[model samples]
Target: MLPRRFNLHRPDRIEDAVALLAEHGDDASPYAGGTELLIAMKARVLSYAHIVDLKGIAALRGVSARSDGGLIIGALTTHHELANHSLVLERLPAYALLSANVANIRVRAAGTLGGNLCFAEPHADPPAMLCALNAELVLAGPGGERRMLLAEFILGELSTARATGEVLVRIEVPGLPAGTRAGYRAFGHLERPAVGVAAVALPLGKGFDWRLRVGSICGRPTALAGLEKAMRGLPEADALAVLAEGAEQAAAAVEADDDIRGSAEYKRHLVGVLARRAARAALGMEALAA
Candidate 1:
């Protein structure tokens, strides 16, 4: 099957791209990487009369350092590029590992981070890890720019907070505090994940600060607030104990969906298992229990 005929507009500047989308309104969509958009169009799930190509916009590419020791990643960056970037490897190796393992080589080579987030696929990977890292997003539009946390940006499955004319410009990640460690783990039968978990641990006085996020099975990446609170400010041994005891309850509390991926109950079980493994991995231990 083929997509319906549509006009392609290649815009070399952000302003031009924004104007094209704003003018076309619901008839247009910003195109980058095309890993998701092209597939949907071919399947007849979505149609756009005007496709605004953003690859010509030079400003929407590359990786740079933040003065605060974090990273500023261009929205158009490919998964493969991010997986191998020196700064990304040095500052957020867990995220790099996740990127390197996203889908397969072909997707990694062509899929853009911006496109993945904008597509808001429930079984995607980056959103969970980025949420754990407390990443912020910048969206450009005719009215100017809007900034929001990645968690807030994703409203539901295949939906985001982006207005019709907005373009995701760059993603900003805050510097992890000293003694912080992060890890990610996922389980899936094929190219997409069924369940994915991300954990972050930071030393706080005599205890530790913990952040845990579960994705893929849910409509949006979900933070395990109850579990985090139970483990926060506890000694390493105590925290691990709390995690072991509370992981299942926390996973069960999440709002999940039953689809081709797996049943909601089974996906919830994977979340508990992955959460433990991710936590251990973050603390520099083996992911599997002996």
Candidate 2:
């Protein structure tokens, strides 16, 4: 149960929400779907005097196509909606797959993409996948609306660039070229294998271009840009070697922790393995068609 003394503020408009946040500052926490926030509150990890629920605001829901052939997902759209949306499945299958695998059916039903990102859990899935797809985050606050890359938005573990009154409005994923295919993979614990080392990969242009993001095992999901760079213009054998090298480099860069789930060394190894598997799956799909 949540703390009894706290107040709940349900604003009908985004402006009102911002005003409340600006006025109350740290005392007020913006509530999206509340899957993580509520749980944290119950666990006493988060304590706030007032809750600004964003669900009643109509602006924070739905999935729509952008003019640039990408997608604009509202902050409050539930994981269930994203996983099953026709447009999402057709165009951004990587995201759809990631959404489906976030947790069990009930958690997916209750969790919102915005809430997941806002929580910024080190083991979260969406952030890394968004980074792989080169997604951007839109924010609204007292200073006015602005956009930032996903990498920039997630500054560190359990942290973001959102200021005192800023709220994430939506996430925008730009279009990919034709002949692109994407996939997501994860290795969970024995009892919950689905939540462990998660990886997403995208292959484009008849396999000429590729990208992959690995999450859920480190402090944050990391984009394999170095791997993508090394694989550019290389043949299959050379590309695989480059990918492995890049994975090693990325693993080296990660600052993981020794948690109940696994040791830091194990998590780093998981990242490398998942990265290779995801990349291979994406590239293998391309090979089968050719």
lDDT of each: 0.91, 0.75
Give the clash total for candidate 2: 2
- Please report the TM-score between candidate 1 and the true structure: 0.97
Candidate 2 residue-wise lDDT at 259: 75
lDDT at 67, model 2: 80
* Candidate 1 stretches greater than 4 Å from native: 287-290
Q: Per-residue lDDT of 1-290 in model 2, one digit per residue for the tens?
A: 65546899999899999999999999999998777888888978889998999989899888999887899999998889998999898887767876877678888898899888888876676777688777899999998999998878887778888888888899999887665555556676742332233233344333356666666665556666676766765665677787777776677666667777788787777777776766665555422111
TM-score of each: 0.97, 0.88
Worst 10 residues of 2 by lDDT: 191-200
> How does residue 98 of candidate 2 score in lDDT?
69
* Pairs that clash in candidate 2: 188-193, 188-196
Compared with the true structure, what per-residue lDDT tens digits does model 1 show for residues 47-130? Answer: 999999999998999999999889999999999999999999999888889999998999999999999999999899999989
Clashes of each: 0, 2
